[model samples]
Target: MTGRATPRSGALFERAQSVTPGGVNSPVRAFSAVGGTPRFIRSARGAWLTDVDGHEYVDLICSWGPMLLGHAHPEVLEAINEAVARGTSYGTPTEPEVLLAEEIVARTPVEKVRFVSSGTEATMSAIRLARGFTGRDVVIKFAGCYHGHVDALLASAGSGLATLAVPGTPGVPASAAGETIVLPYNDRAAVTAAFAEHGDRIACLITEATPGNMGVVPPEPGFNGFLAQTCRDHGALFISDEVMTGFRATREGGWGLDGAVEGWTPDLMTFGKVMGGGFPAAAFGGRADVMGRLAPEGPVYQAGTLSGNPIATTAGLATLRLATPEVYAALSATADTIIGAVVDALTAAGVPHAVQRAGTMFSVFFRDGAVSDFAGASTQDTAAFAAFFHAMLDAGVYLPPSAFESWFVSAAHDERAVATVLDALPIAAQAAAKASA
Candidate 1:
C-alpha cells in the first residue's frame, strides 16, 4: 500500500507557524520528535480520526487518554448537548457538579472532591492542600513522574543536590524548585533518604500512581504501598496524581491496580483525562478532614471561576457512568491484542524493544530490557522509534507522536481498529529495525 499524503495538514502547519508557537498549542503536537507535519484532525468518531486532508487513520492516542469510551460517543455527546442547552457556566453551584463529585467520591478513596478546570489545576490544588494540611514546605517527586507544570514540581535533580532539585525550566524560580526532592522512580532507598533528611519539613510526596508520561513505567511490586507507608511514618501526605490514569486504568484508577488490594490509599488524589469525558475538567480529593483545610472551610484558599462548569461535569459524569466493568474488559482485551502484536512484530523484525504496561495503559520502548525508571526509559532508540512512528502514520495508524508516551486504546477500538493497527505493526517494526541498523 502507498503512503497517505497530508498536503492539507502540511499547508495548515506552515500557516499556523506564522501565528502559533511551533504551529501547535501543545508542544508534542508540533511533531518535533518525529520529523513530520502534525495531522490536523478534522473530526473523530469511535476509534478513527479524520485529518483535514480527508485521510482516515485508526486513532491510538485517543486524545492523550481522555476518550475512554472513544471520540464523540453518542451518550457523552447527548449529555454535553443537554448541558449546553441548559447553560455552559453559571458561577453558581450546579446539579451536574454535585452529582459528579458524589460519583468520584464513591468510586475512589476520596471522601470529598473539589472540581478544577484542568489536570494542572487538580495537581496544583492537591499540592497546596497537602502543604496547608501538614504545615510543611518541602515536596518529593519521582524523576519520570509528571505532575503538571506547577512551579515547585518542575524540577530536576543535580549531582550535588541529589535529594534537592533545581528548576527544570526557565520560568520556574530557583526558590520554588529548591523545595522539591526529585528521586528516581521505583527507588525505595532514595525516597527513604529524602524523608530521613527532610522529614520534619516535608509536606507531601506526589507521584503518578503508574507513570504513563515516561512510557507507562509501572511501579515495582509494593513500591506504591511503600511510598504510602513512608509518608504515613513521616506525617506527610501522599498525593497520587492520577490525571492520566484515573478511571481509564481500571475503574478506580491506578489505585484499583494496587492500593485497593494492598490496603493503602493516598492522602489525596488528582484526576483528569477519562473522568472529564474529553472536556476540560479535573478534580482533587481525599480524606474529608485533610480536604476540609481548603478554602471556605479551614485556611488554604483555592478557587476557580469555571471550577465546576456544568457542561464539563455533565460530560464527566456521563463518561464515568458508562465506563462499566464491560467497557474496561473490552479496553483490556483490545490493549492485550495490540501489545501482543507490537511485541511479535518487533521481535520478528529483530528490533530491540521493551513493552511495559499498567492495566490498560502501556508503551513500547525501543530497548531490550524492562524500564523501571526514567533513566532506563531515556535509553530507548529514539531514532528507531521515529522511523517506526512515521511508518505507522504512513500506514494509516495514528500513534502518539513521541516514543516517551503511552499508546492508549479505548473501548471503541473494535475489531476494525485493532485490525488496522495490527496490519501496520509489521511494516513499522521493519522500519524501526532498518533505523537501528
Candidate 2:
C-alpha cells in the first residue's frame, strides 16, 4: 500500500514551527526519532486515523492508549453530547464525577478517588498525599518509568525524554531532583538498598504498574509484590503509577496481572489514558486513610479548576461501562495475532528482535534477549526501528513513532485492522533488516 501524500501535513507543520516550539505540543509527536513528517490527523473512528493528507491508516497508537473502545465510540459520544447539553464545567460538584469515581473504585483496589485533568496531576498529587500521610520527604521512582512530566518525576523519565536521548532534564532544580532516588527497574536489590539507606526519610516509591513508557518493560515476576512488601516494612507508601496501563492493559489494569492475583494492593494508585476515554481525565486514589490527607478533608492541598469536569467524567464513565470482559478478550486476541506475526516476520527477515508484552500492551524492541529494565530497553537499535517505522507508515499502519513507547490496540481492532498491520509487518521487518545490514 502506498500512503497518500502528506502535503497538507507538511504545510501545517511548517506553519506550526513558527508558533509552537518544535511544531508540536508534545516532543514525541515531532517524529524527531522516526525521521518523517508527522501526520496531522483530520479525524478518527473505530480503529483508523484519517490524516490531513487524506491518508487512512490503521491506528496502532490509539491516542496513546486512551481509546479503549476506539475513537468516537457511539456510547461515549452520546454521553459527551448529553453532558455538553446540560453544561460544560461548573466550579461546583457534578453527578458524573461521583459516578465515575464509583466506577473506578468498583474495578480497582482504590477505595476513594480524586479527579485530575491529566496523568501528571494524578501522580504529582498522589506523591504529595503520600508524603503528607507519612511525614517523609524522599521518594523512590524507577528509571524509565514515566509517571509524567511533573518536575521531580522528569529527572530521568522515559517516553519523550528517552526518544530525544536526553538524560535528566535541565530546569529541574538540583534540590527537587535530589528528593527522588532513581533506581533501575526490575532490580529488587536496588530497591531494597534504596529503602535501607533512606527508609526513615522515604515517603513513597512510585512505579508504572507495567511500565509502558520504556516500551512495555514488564516487571519481573513478583517484583511489584516485593516492592509493596519492602515499602510496608520501611513504613513507606507504595504508589502504583498506572497512567498508561490502567484499564487498557486489562479490565483491572496492570494490577489485575499481579496485585489482584496476589491479594495485595498499593497504598496509592494513579490512573489515566483509558479511564478518560480519549479525553483529558485522570485520577489518583488508594486507601481512604492516605487519600484523607488531601485538602478539604485533611491538608495536603491540591486543586484544579477543571478537576472532574462534567464532560470528561461522563465520557470516562461511559467508556468504563462499555469496557467489559468481552472488550478485554478482543484486545488480547488481537494483540496475540499481531505480536505473533511480528515475531515471525522479523525472524524471517533476519532481523534480531524481542517482543515484550504487559497484559494486552506490547512493543517490538530492536534487539535480542529479554528487556527487563531501562538499561536493557535502551540497547534497542533505534535507527533500525526508525526505518521500520517509516516503512509501516508508508504501508498504512500507524505505529508509535518512538521505539520507547508501547503499541496500543483497542477493542475496536477487528480482524480487518489486525490484517492491515499483519500485511505491513514482513515488509517493515525487511526494511529494519536492511537498515541494520
Candidate 3:
C-alpha cells in the first residue's frame, strides 16, 4: 500500500466490465469524468470507507448524501436486518409506508408523500402529475439542474444538446424534450422571458430548490422566490426536487432552511437519498390540491412496484427519527470545521479556491468567491480539481468524485474523521497548485 499498490478494485473493474456497462451501474461511478479507476469500497463505518485496497478515507461523499448518519449506524443496520427477516418486497400496502408518510408529512412543507424507488422516479412522476394537474404540456427547468434521466429532462440545446455530452444524453428523442424549456439558472430575466413567452403552456417550474448538479451553486437570494411567484402567476405548479438537499441541507431540511426562510413553498417537493437512509426509497408530494391529482385520487397515474417496500420505509423512518436537531447541529459543526480547515489549508498554500455550503452540504470549488450559477461554476479549473481529488483519494480522504458534485457531511463524521480530511487538504491543495501550473 506504500507505493499505491493496485487495489482489488482493479480486478473487480475488469470482471465488472464484462457484465456491467463501463464497469459501473452509474455513469459517474465509471471514473470517466475523472480519470482513474473507481475505488471499490468493501465496507464502511462511521465517516470512513475502507476500500478493497485496505485504504481508509474520511468519506465526504457519504453515499451521495444518504449516509447522513454515516455508513451503517447500528440502528439503521438493525432496522434493515430486522426488516429483511420480515421479508423484502410484499408488493402490497404495508403499515410502515403509512408511518413513513406520516413522518414525512409531519416534517417538511408537504401534506402527503408517495414513495418511489429512486430520485429519478420521484421527479419523473412528479412532472407527470404536474402536467396532469395543470393540463399543460410544457415544464421549465434550470440549465444545470439534473432531474434524472427522464426523457423530458435529458435535454440541452446547442452542440452539446445534439452530441449528448452533458444534459443531452443519447437514446432520448428530441421530441420528448420539446416540451421542456431550459433556462439559465439564477437568471431572473431569462426566467421572466420564458414565462412571458410561454407562461400559459408551461405546466410546472421544476427545479432543485438549491442546485448541487452544477458544482454546488446555491440559489441566488430571491431566485427561488421568483420561481414560486412566477409559477403562481402563470398557473404553473412549482416542483422542488430536493433529493440531495432534503435532510442534509440543515437542521430541518433543504426547504426547511432555504425556502421556508424565504417564505416560498413549492407546490410539489421530492425527497430521496437521506429519507431512504441508504435504501432505494424516494417520494414526491406537496399541496393536497396537486398531490391529489395522482392515481386513485384522480386521473394522473403514477405507481412503483417496489414503492414503500417495508425495508426502505423502516430505514427511512429510523433515519428520520435519529436525525434530531442535535444530529443536524453536529453535522453543521463538523462541516464548518472541515470547510474552514480546507480553506485555510488552500490559502496558506496559495491555491485560489472557494467553498460553497448549504447547511451540511458543501463543495470545494477550484476557484475563488461565490458560484451563483452553472456558467460561473463552469469557470472552475477541473484539471486543478482532478489533481486535488486524486491527492485526497491518495491521502485517504474521499470527496465527491466530480468537481460538480457536493461533498456531504453526516452526523457520524465526528472530530476524528474531520481532522483526517482537514490534514489532507494542504497536501491536496499543494498538488492542485502544481497541477494547475
Candidate 4:
C-alpha cells in the first residue's frame, strides 16, 4: 500500500476545519505534531486504511486501540448489519445487550456490569460508583494514565490531550480538581505516600493496569499487587481503568496483571476500545455486591439513552468472539515483530531511545534508558518524534502522532503488514537522528 494523499483528502480536511475543531473529530488527527495535513480516511479493510486519494497504508495505530480485527472485517460487518436491520436505538433493554454483558462477565469474570456510550462514560461512571461504594471523595491516579475526560481523572491524561501538552483543562472547577491527587506511575513510593496521607477519605484509586497514556509503562514488579493490597488495607476500592488495556492487553482484560502479576483483583474495572469494535461501547464491572448498588437496586445515578445499543453490542460481541487465544497469539507476535524491528533500526541508526511493550501494545520513546514514570516519559524528545512521525507518514506508514500514546497491534496485522513497518523503520530512524542532532 502506498501512502499518497489524494486531492480529495486535502480538500476534505480543509473543508472540515471550517466546521470541526482542528479539522478533525479528535485532536491528534490534525497531524499537529507531525506538521502536515491529515489524511482523510475513505475506508479501511483488514490491516490497511485507504485514504480518499485511493492510497493505502498499513495501520499501526489501529483506530487508537479498537479495530483489533482490522476495519470492516466481514464477520464484524455482518454482525453490525444484522443488528441494524432490527432497528437502532431502543433506549431500553435489548437481548444483545444482555448477551454482550454476559459475555463480558464470563470473559473478564466480573460479577456485574453497567454499559456506557464511550470509554469516557465508562470511566466517569466508574469513578462515581467508586466514590459511592467507598463513601470517600479523594481519588488516587497516576500522572500519565489517562482515564478519559472525567474531570477528576484528567489531572494528567495521555493521548491527544497529552500531545497538546495541556496539564488539565481550565473549565474543571478547582473544587473538583482538589479531590484528585496525581502520582507518578511505576513509582510505588508515591502511591504509598498518597495513601499514608489521605487513606481514610480516599474513595478509590483509579489507574491503568499498564500505563498506556505515557507510552505503555508496565507495572514495575508487584506494583499492581501493592495497589490492591493498599486499597484493601485503607478500606479503599481499587478501580482498574482498563478502557484502553481491556481486551487489547489480553482476553481476560488486563486482569492478567493480577494473576501473572501477583494474584489480586481490583474492586472495579472499566473497559472500552477493543470491546467496542470501533464503535462507542464501553462498560464497568466488578464485585456483584458493588455493581448491584448501581441503579434500581442502589442509589448511584448513571444512565445513557444509547448505553447498550444493539449494533454497538453486536459489534462488540463479534469482536470479542474473534479475540480467542489464537487471535491473541497473532497480535502478540505482530507487536513483537514491529517493536523489535523498530528497536533494532534505532540502535543501528544510533538513535537514543527505549521501547516499552505490554501484550500487543508498544511505543517508541525517543529518550535514553527506561521511562518509569510520567516525568521520565515526558523526557522523550518530542521535537525528534515529530520529525520521525512525518517521515514515517511520508514513507506510507501511520504511527501514533504523539510520543505519549501506545501503538496498537491487531490480529489483522499479518506478517506482510509487519514487514512493511520493518521496511519503513530505517527511514524513520534516520529522520529521528537528524531531528535529534
Candidate 5:
C-alpha cells in the first residue's frame, strides 16, 4: 500500500507548492504529520470520495465535520441550486438569513443569532462582544481548544498546531497572545485558580463545548456547569465555541449532551460545521440582551460584507430543516458501530489505545488510558497513527490525517461505509502495532 501510486496527487502537490504555502491552504491538509501525499479529491457524495488519481475511499473526514447529511445531499443541493438561480450574495437582507437565524434560535439556547462567513468570524465577534459588554481586556481559553486562528484565541490551540508539533504559531503578536489566559482542559482547579486571580479583569472564558481538536475530549461531568457558575460569579461571559460540534455532534450540539441535562446555558455560543451544510456559514448568539451589544444595536461593532450570503444561508437552513430526530439517531448508531470496531481491531492487534467520544464525534488516541487534557493527548504515538492512517488509506478508507482530530461520520455512512471501515481495521491495526515510538 505504501508503494501504491499517487502520481496525480503528487504532481498537483508540486504545482501547488510553487504557488501556496506548504502546498495547502490549511496546515493539516499538507499531511506533514502523517507523511503521505494528500489526496486531492475530485468529487464526493454520500460518504465516498473519488481522488484525482481515480481511487475511491470511504470519507470519514466529512469535510472536517460539516457534511452532516454527507457530501452532495440531494435536498441540500436543490436548496443551493434554487438559491443560486435567484442570487448568490445580495449584500442586503434576505429571507434565508432570517429563516436560518430562526431555525438556530429554535434548536439551541440562543435567543438572537448573527450570521458570519466562517467559524473564525463567529468566535472573533463573540469574543469582541464579550469584551465590549463586560468592559474587560482579558480572555481565558482552554489549552488544546482550537477556536479558529483568531489572534487572541490561537495562543495554545490544537488541531493543526498539535499535528505540526508547534507550541504556538510565530505570527501572533505578543500583546494579542498576552491577553489570553490558557488553562488545561477538564481541570476544575485550574479554572477556579484562573478566575480567582483575574476575575475582575477577565472579559470572558471561551471553551469548546466538547473538544474534538486534541482528540474528542468530552468535558468531565459537571465541568461545563462549573465554568458557567464561575463566570457568573465573576460577572464574566461564558462563551461556548461549538463550531465543530454544533448540529453534527447532536441536534442541540455539545450543549445537548451536558448543558441541557445540567440546566445551564452559555452566555454566548458559536456555531458552524453542519449548520452550513458544507458551505461557508457560521453564527454567534446568546441572550438577546448580550447580543444586543452588536453595532446596529448597541456599540460592539462587528460587520461582514458577505455575512449572510443568500446561497450559504439557504444551504444551512435546508440542512437544519432536514436534521430530524431520526438523523441524530442514525449518527449515534453509526458512531457506536465504528467506534466499537476501532476498539476491537486495536485490541486484536495488541496495540495499546484509547477511544474518546463526544456525542456522535470521536477520535482514536494511540496510547493506553483515559486522556483528559492536552498534555495527555500529546503523548499519543504519532508513528503508530501514521502507520495505521496509511494502511486505512490503502484500503480505501480516508480518515482525518491527524490522530489529534476527530474522525467524522455522517447519516450517509450507511452499513456499506461502516463495513468498509471495519474490513480495513485489522490490517491497519496490525500496521499500527508494528510501528514503534
Candidate 6:
C-alpha cells in the first residue's frame, strides 16, 4: 500500500508551530519520536478517524484510551448534547456529577469520590489529602509510573534504591522533589527498604494500577498486595492511580485483575480516561474516612472551578452505563486477535519483540524479553518501533505516535477494524526488521 497523502496536515502543522510549542498541546502528539508530520484529525466515528487531508484510518490510539466505546458513540453524543442544551457549567453541584460519582464508586473499591478536571488534578489532590490525613511529609512512587505531571511526583530516582529523588524535569523545584522517594517498579525489596528507612516520615506510596505510560508494564503477581501491606505496616496510605486503566482495562479497572481477587484495596484510588467518556473529567476517591479530610469537610483544601462540569459528567455516566460485560468481552476478543497477528507477523519478519498486556490494554515492545520495570521497557529498539509505527500509519492504521505508549482498542473495534490492523502488521514488521538491520 502507498503512504497516504498528508499535505494539508503538514501545512496545518507548520502554521501551528508558529503559535504553539512543538505545534501540539501535548508532547507525544508532536510525533517527534516517530519523525513525521502528525495527522490533524477532522473527525472520528466508531473505530475510524478521518484526518484533515480526507484520508481515513483505523484508530488504534482511541484518544489515548478514553474512547472505550469508540469516538462519537451515539448514546454518549446524545448525553453531551442534552447536557450542553441545559447549560455548560454551573458552579453549583449537578445531578450528572452525583450520578457519575455513584457509578465510579459502584464499580471500584472507592467508598467516596471527588471530581477533578483532569488526571493531573486527581493525582495531585490525592497526594495532598494523603499528607494531611497521615500528618507525614514524604511520598513514595515507582520509576516510570507517571501519576500525571504533578510537581512532587515528577521525580527521578537517585543513585541508590531508597535514595531521595531529583526532579525529572527542569521546572520542578529541588524542595518538591526532595519530598518524594522514587523506586524501581516491580522491585519489592526497594519498596521495603524505602519504607523501612522513611516509614515515620512517609505519608503515602502512589503507583499506577498498571504502568501504561511505559507501554503496559504490568505489576508482578502479588506486587500490589505487597505494596498495600507494606504501606499499612508503616502507617502510610496506599494510592492506586488508575487514570488510564480504570474502566478501560476491565469493568472494574486494574483492581479487578488483582486487588479484588486478592482481597486487597487501595486506601485512595484515582480515575480518569474512560470514566470521562472522552471528556475532561477525572476523580480521586477512597475510604470515606480518608476522603473526609478534604476541605468543606476537613482541613486539607482543594478546589476547582470546573471540577464537575455537567457535560463531562453526563458523558461519563452514559459511557459507564453503556459499558456492559458484553462490550468488554468484545474488546478482549478484538485485542486477542490483534495481539496474535502482531506476534505472528513479527516472528515471520525475524523481528525481536515482546507484547505485554494488562487486562485489555497492551503494547508491543521492540525486543524479545518480558518487561517488568521501566528499565526493561526502556531497552526496546525505539528506532525499530519508529519504523514500524510509520509503516502502519502509512497503511491507514493510526497507532499511538510514540513507541512507549499502549495501543488502545475500543468496543467499537469490529471485524473490519481488526482486519485493517492485521493487514498492516506484516509490512510494519518487515519495516522494523530493516530498521534493526
lDDT of 2 by residue, 293-408 (tens): 88899988999999999999999999999999998998998999999999999999999899999888999999999899999999999989999999999999999999999998
What does the lDDT read for residue 7 in candidate 4? 84
Clashing pairs in 3: none
Top lDDT prediction, candidate number: 6
Worst 10 residues of 4 by lDDT: 157-166
* lDDT score at residue 125, model 4, on the 0-100 scale: 91
- For model 4, the local distance difference test gives 0.83
Candidate 6, residues 1-437, lDDT tens digits: the string is: 23778899999999999999999999999999988899999999999999999988999999999999999999899989988999999899999999999999999999999999999999999999999999999999998899999999999998899999999999999999999999999999999899888899999999999999999999999999999999999999999999999998999999999999999999999999998999999999999999999999999999999999999999999999999999999999999999999999999999999999988899999998999999998999999998999999988899998889999999889889899999999999999999999
Per-candidate TM equals: 0.99, 0.97, 0.96, 0.95, 0.97, 0.99
For residues 1-437, could you state the per-residue lDDT of candidate 5 as single tens digits?
A: 46358899999999999999999999999999899799998999999999999998999989999998999999999999998999778889999999999999998999999999999999999999999999998888888899999988878543321111123678987678877888889888877877877789889999999999999998999999999999999999999999999987889999999999989999999999888888899999999999998989999899999998899989999999998999989999999999999999999999989998888899999999999999999998999999999999999999989989998988899888899999999999999999953
Q: In model 6, which regions exceed 4 Å deviation?
A: none
lDDT by residue for model 1 (1-437), tens? 23678899989999999999899998999989888788999999999999999988999999999999999999999989988998788999999999999999989999999999999999999999999999999999989889888999889985643468999999999999999999999988888888888999999999999999999999999999999999999999999999999998899999999999989999999999888889899999999999999889989999999998999999999999999999999999999999999999999999999999888899999998999999999999999999999999998899999999999999889888899999999999999999999
Task: Mark the regions of model 4 whose C-alpha exceeds 4 Å error after superposition.
Answer: 1-6, 156-167
Alpha-carbon shift of residue 363 in model 4 (angstroms): 0.7
Best candidate per TM-score, number? 6
Decide which is better by TM-score, 5 or 6: 6
Writing each residue's lDDT as its tens digit, candidate 4 over 219-298 gives 88888888989999999989888888888888886777564456688889999988888889999999999898788899
After superposing candidate 5 on the true structure, give the runs of residues whose Cα lies further than 4 Å from its correct spot: 1-3, 156-167
The TM-score of candidate 5 is 0.97
